[model samples]
Target: MYFTPALLAAVATVIGLATATPVPEPQGIAAGSIELCTGQYLQGRCTTITTPTGTCVEFPRGFHNDVSSVSGLEGWNCNLYHDDHCTSASYYVQGEQDTLPTDNFNSVICTPPP
Candidate 1:
């Protein structure tokens, strides 16, 4: 196959636009992984979730009582973003996490080990 700079640029543009999501949506999601959650999973009351899997998980658009603090389980690490699409800066969280930088997040991205 042959490639061109113009072609690459076009592809990049398409991908960028396609990936852009509103602040209420998530950009990336992990699949089939061991994850742990306590004290609210998705705007609900304090609860725990294990071995969670999904295409993507997005928090509420604004503040929420449950969007704060997260800890991974069994070698699971995740990234928290302040934007809905995980496009903004990221806050990494792993085992025994109880607090976030902003006490709330817009998105969470996690992937299982290779």
Candidate 2:
């Protein structure tokens, strides 16, 4: 088969993209962050979020009413709220919480220990 210049360039581009090393995800826990999981006993789908000291952030998308366990608090005081925007019933969490009182918390605000 005869290869045209454009075809060769396109093949090269495709090859580069196919063989290029992908950017790896973070390996472990970073400072000022926590992990939440969907299963009790710290098993199953889990995601990490930056706590940003004393800021309130809602559980994004899938995590809403889905987190059954938590870990990596690292001395941060986390107040888990039952309503969005950190209102209504809330539960306090410090240190690694293998399981929450309930998995229905919709928002959380974590403050680093002084």
Candidate 3:
């Protein structure tokens, strides 16, 4: 069978639509990532943490008790702790936390949303 240009274009459109994936809400931020900032309202020095497989991460030395803002938790749930290894005091956070409940957290464990 001979295929015309219009027919090919139509087929491509259909294929593209069929294979397209729905974009989750709050685009840009990935499913398992969080941003930590030293100032409130997401200002000042900032760093991003990615835990695609749900892992515990410790804040670098001097960063402990210095994170006043947190963001990029669109599809993730993270537990902030006041001690290393995700121990001691903990605060649960999800979504953009422009001003963290507490800025003394020293460790975090981030997991993708269920």
Candidate 4:
């Protein structure tokens, strides 16, 4: 077997990346949601976003507001729904925010890019 310096470097790089945990860096709302936020929201701040693996979730204040605005920071895209279990999904938007019918969304589902 022959070992090239370039090949060795490439292998090391791949190994490093594969072992890295994404829980530290910010992956925006969706990945953030998946990693820790859901449980927090469900259990009342189970973790704080300041923690390396923690995240935050926020919702708007009362009546005069609608979820008329949504954002998919860092290419995040999701289907906002007025009902649970992802019924009636909103259109997909990326690298920018999405808007929904005023204050209507109650649940959301994330979809990978095609």
Please give each candidate's TM-score: 0.48, 0.69, 0.67, 0.37
Name the lDDT value of residue 113 in candidate 2.
77
Query: Candidate 1 residues 1-114, lDDT tens each?
Result: 998999999999999999958676574544533232324432323333333343345653333324555656556667767766777787877565665556556566665655
Per-residue lDDT of model 4, residues 7-107, tens digit only: 99999999998895857676663342221122211232222221111222233223122344544434444555565444454544443343343456545
Candidate 4 residues lying further than 4 Å off, grouped into runs, are: 1-65, 98-101, 112-114
User: For candidate 3, which ten residues in a row score worst on lDDT?
Assistant: 24-33
Give the per-residue lDDT digits (tens) of candidate 3, residues 1-114. 999999999999999989969786775434477788899998998888775545678887667899998875677788888988776878988888888877888888887767
Candidate order, lDDT descending = 2, 3, 1, 4
Better of 2 and 4 by TM-score: 2
User: In TM-score terms, which candidate is top?
Assistant: 2
- On lDDT, the stronger of 1 and 3 is 3
In model 1, pairs of residues that clash are: none
Candidate 4, residue 37: CA error in Å? 17
Lowest summed lDDT window (length 10), candidate 2 = 26-35
Q: Residue 62, candidate 1: how far off, in angstroms?
A: 8.6
Question: What residue runs in model 1 are displaced by over 4 Å at the alpha carbon?
Answer: 1-44, 47-55, 60-66
What local distance difference test score does each model get?
Answer: 0.56, 0.82, 0.80, 0.42
Candidate 2 per-residue lDDT, tens place, 1-114, comes to: 899999999999999889968789976532377788999877889898887666777887888899898875677888889988887978988878888878998888888777
* Residue 13 error, candidate 1, Å: 60
TM-score of 2: 0.69
